[model samples]
Target: MIAIAIKNLSYHYPDRTPALLDINLQVKRGLKTAILGMNGSGKTTLLYHLNGVIPVESGEVQVFGTPVVKERITEVRRMVGLLFDNPDNQLFSTTLRNDIAFGPRNLRLEPALVHRKVEEAMQLLSIEDLADRPPYCLSLGQKKRAAIAGLISMEPQVLVFDEPFSGLDPALGRQFRELLDELVSGGCTLVYSTHDVDLAYAWADEVVLMHSGRVLKSGPVDLLCDEKTMMRANLPVPLLGRLFQGWNEKPRTLEEALNLMGSTGLAKGKRLQA
Candidate 1:
């Protein structure tokens, strides 16, 4: 089933600056898709249409076959949860617990049900201990987890994230990826935008390369293996592809690269002595 369909999409800023132009794309349900581009490439503008965050000015955006129009905007938002780049923008409650509970409470669920939902989301994001603290008092990573917990409480079928990992150290980033994996495992479709080629190559099921308000290409992760296309997009080839450029087998992930190295005896005598 198709989770998202965007056709003939175009957008312009109020000042007459073009943001997106003639975009046509489709994402399958339960797949992880990465929008790849440099800054100002219209990736974020296109994502905002998924949940009607930005009104469709010139084209159509469908979420799971439902049109994202003002008449059904609430339904679209219910089906698609968007995570802003800044957790502060998503969180506006006094305490972390309140922030996490906001979504369910707004849905008018029974109080007990809302509590259960909040509890489950907190546990899922491992943010239970930070519940009573104020959002402003928590670290950036903690605030991110709290914001995500709130979204998880909504149980949206599709999660739209704009630069979800913009400011995290390596450990926190891995934790976030693990959380995303858990969501995908539970049948949620994931669509996120990122400028990091390595992250997109290693994590996404597919890649949509955008440039100058247009889609350069959209296909399997292997599409990133083409150095020429990466260059044309003005983005670097994924680090993995660069590291193994001439090899017949190009591995996209670290494990795959290690396996390739083992198979080719590249690591035979390179082990560091203890």
Candidate 2:
């Protein structure tokens, strides 16, 4: 099943500045997909259309076979959860606990059910300690966690995140990644945008490369190995890609690269000690 389908999608800012042009893409159900691009590449603008955050000005966007239009926007939003790059845009409640409980409450679920969802989300995000604190008093990372907790409490089927790693420390980043894995394992579809080629290369099952509001290329993770395409998109080759530049085989993760390098003695000086 296709989780998202976008065709001939185009958008322009209020000032008439083109933000997206003739985009055509599809994300498979339950797969991890990345929108890879440089800054000002229209990554965020394209994401907004997935959940009807930005109404389609031209062409169409469909989430799980439902067209993103006013008539079906509620249904679309219910299925797809979007996490903004800046937490401030999503976290508006006076208290962190209330912010996390906002979505579940909006659904009009029983108060007990809403409370349970809030507690689960807070525990998953490790922000239970900040429950009573005002959002303004927390650090940027804490705010990001709170925002994520709020979204998770909704339990949307498709998760769309814009630069999800922006404010997370290493430990928090790893924790969030594990949570994403758990969600996907439970049959959720994941889509995220990022300018980090290395992260996309190592993490995404597929990627759509964008440049100047246009899709330069879209394909399996192997597409990142295309030096010409990466150059055209103004993105450097991923670290692993550069290391395996001329090799017949390219490994996606560090552990795989290390194994291959050890077996082939590709490392210049002594092979990585076991």
Candidate 3:
């Protein structure tokens, strides 16, 4: 089912240079979608519109079938959780554990429920080790995971992540990807924006390429993240992407790549091929 919908959406800054124009999009439950764009491409601006942080100058946005208006804005925002790139912006509690529990506590869930939720979220994000640490003391990666844990505690149906990988180390990027996969399995819808074509291609079921505040293309990752499409989007498919370009096989996940290579027998038996 469609958890979020945006139709004919457009936005403009106070400077009024146009942030988005005629944007139509839908996010289904339990699906992972990547919104890819370079700087000044309106990725974050559009994300703001999704959760109703920025009112649309023209268009309609509905979250979980809740039409966004002043009266219903809080409802919409509650239904859609947002994890900004910087965890500092989202994590407000004195400690990681408190930050994780803060959301459910605000919702008035039972104390037991709140504790369970926080523990589950922290464990799921694999940051149980950092649960008691101060939010400001965490490394960039741990802070990001804590931010995600905070969002998870809220248990929103749809999540909008803005540049979750920015400033993250390579290992952290992969760890975040695993968390995203787990979130999708748990039936949380995701729409994350990033400038990295490679990670977007690896993790996203659908890639939406935006440029000049317009959607240049939207399609399967393999189709839109190809060489030609990358060139059109002014991005590059990673070295692995270059290796797997075309040839009838689609490698969506890391495991799929290894399986494909082994299944296709990329290396022949030359006596030393054990």
The CA lDDT of each predicted structure is 0.90, 0.92, 0.82
Better of 1 and 3 by TM-score: 1
TM-score, per-candidate, Cα-based? 0.94, 0.95, 0.88
- Report the Cα lDDT for residue 191, model 1: 96
Q: Compare candidates 1 and 2 on TM-score and give the better one.
A: 2
Name the top lDDT candidate: 2
lDDT of 3 by residue, 1-274 (tens): 9887889988888997888989988877788889987788889988888777788688898887888767787788778888886778888778899999988988889999999999998888789998888899988888988998888889888889999888777886777778778778988888999877767777788778888898877876775546676677777776567777765886766788877877777634332576
Name the best candidate (by TM-score).
2
What candidate 1 gets wrong by more than 4 Å, as runs, is 271-274
- For residues 1-274, write the lDDT of model 1, one tens digit per residue: 8999999999998898999999999998898999999889998889888988889989899998999999999899999999987899888889999998999998899999999999999997788899999999988878888888899899999999988888776887898799889889888999999988899999999999999999999999989988888888999888898899888888888999999888887776577442
Clash count for candidate 1 is: 0
Worst ten-residue run, lDDT, model 1? 265-274
Off by over 4 Å in 3: 170-172, 238-241, 269-274
Steric clash pairs (candidate 1): none
CA-RMSD of model 2:
1.9
